[model samples]
Target: MSTRIEVVAGRRRWTVEQKLAILRDAFGPEGSVGDACKRHAIGSGSIYTWRRQAMSGELGGARPAPLPSFAEVELSAPVPGLPTAGSHIEIELPSGVKLTVDSGVDADALARVVAVLTR
Candidate 1:
C-alpha cells in the first residue's frame, strides 16, 4: 500500500486594517458576506467575530452598517402631452416612506431605488 501526505499551511495573520476592510466589504452597498468570505479566504465565523468586535468598538472603528433589504416597485409610463420628459408620481406608504418617481423612469431601476429607500 502507498501512503500519501499533504502539506498544511500555517495560520494566516490579518492586520486590523485588513480585518476592517473585509468587514466593510461584507456589509457595504452591493457587498455580499459569502462573496467577501470567499475573496478573503476566510469563513463566516471569522467574519461574525470581526463584526461583533467592530460593534463593540474593539476593532478600533465604528460598527458596520447593515445591508439594506429590497422591495418591489411598480411604475407606469407618463401620460403623453405633459410638455415634459415625464410626469412625477408621489407615493406615501403607511410606513411613512415617501417615493417620487418619474413615469418615464425604467421600472427595474425605479424598483431598485424604491427597494433601497424602503429598506
Candidate 2:
C-alpha cells in the first residue's frame, strides 16, 4: 500500500510590474538571484528569463543609458571658476588662465582645451 500527497497551487498570478519589482529587489546591490530564489522558493531559470527580457528592452521602467565617453564629448572652453590643471591652491592653466569647470569633467579634454587656449 502507498500513500499519496496532494499539492495546492497559488491562486495569484504575478503581473509584469510585479515581476520587475521582484527582479529589481532581487538583483539590488545587496541581493542576488540565487539568494532570492532560495528565500522565495523560486526557480533559478525564471530569474534568468526575467533578466533577459529586461536587457532586451522588453521590460519598461528600466534605468537610462550611461553617459558617453570623453572621446565622444565635444571639446569646449572651461566654465568660469572651474578647476584647471595646477598644484594645490593654484588653478594652473597652461596659459596661466584660471577657469571653473564642473566636477567629473574629463581631465584629458581639459588639458587639450587649455593647451589650445594657451597657444
Report the C-alpha lDDT of model 1 over 1-119, residue by residue, as the tens digit: 99999988998999999998999899999888999999999998999998878765667755534444445554387556543556687768544888887856766777677566544
Structural similarity to truth (TM-score) of each candidate: 0.45, 0.41
List, residue by residue over 1-119, the lDDT tens digit for candidate 2: 99999988975466788777778768887878878888766787877887777764555655634332344554498767744555233346533587766655567887676555543
> What residue runs in model 1 are displaced by over 4 Å at the alpha carbon?
1-5, 61-119
- The C-alpha local distance difference test score for the whole of candidate 2 amounts to 0.66
- Pairs with backbone N, CA or C atoms under 3 Å apart (clashes), candidate 1: none
- For residue 118, model 2's alpha carbon misses the true position, in angstroms, by 40
- Per-model CA lDDT versus the true structure: 0.76, 0.66
Q: In candidate 1, what residue range of length 10 has the lowest lDDT sum? A: 66-75
Model 2 stretches astray by more than 4 angstroms: 1-4, 8-12, 60-119
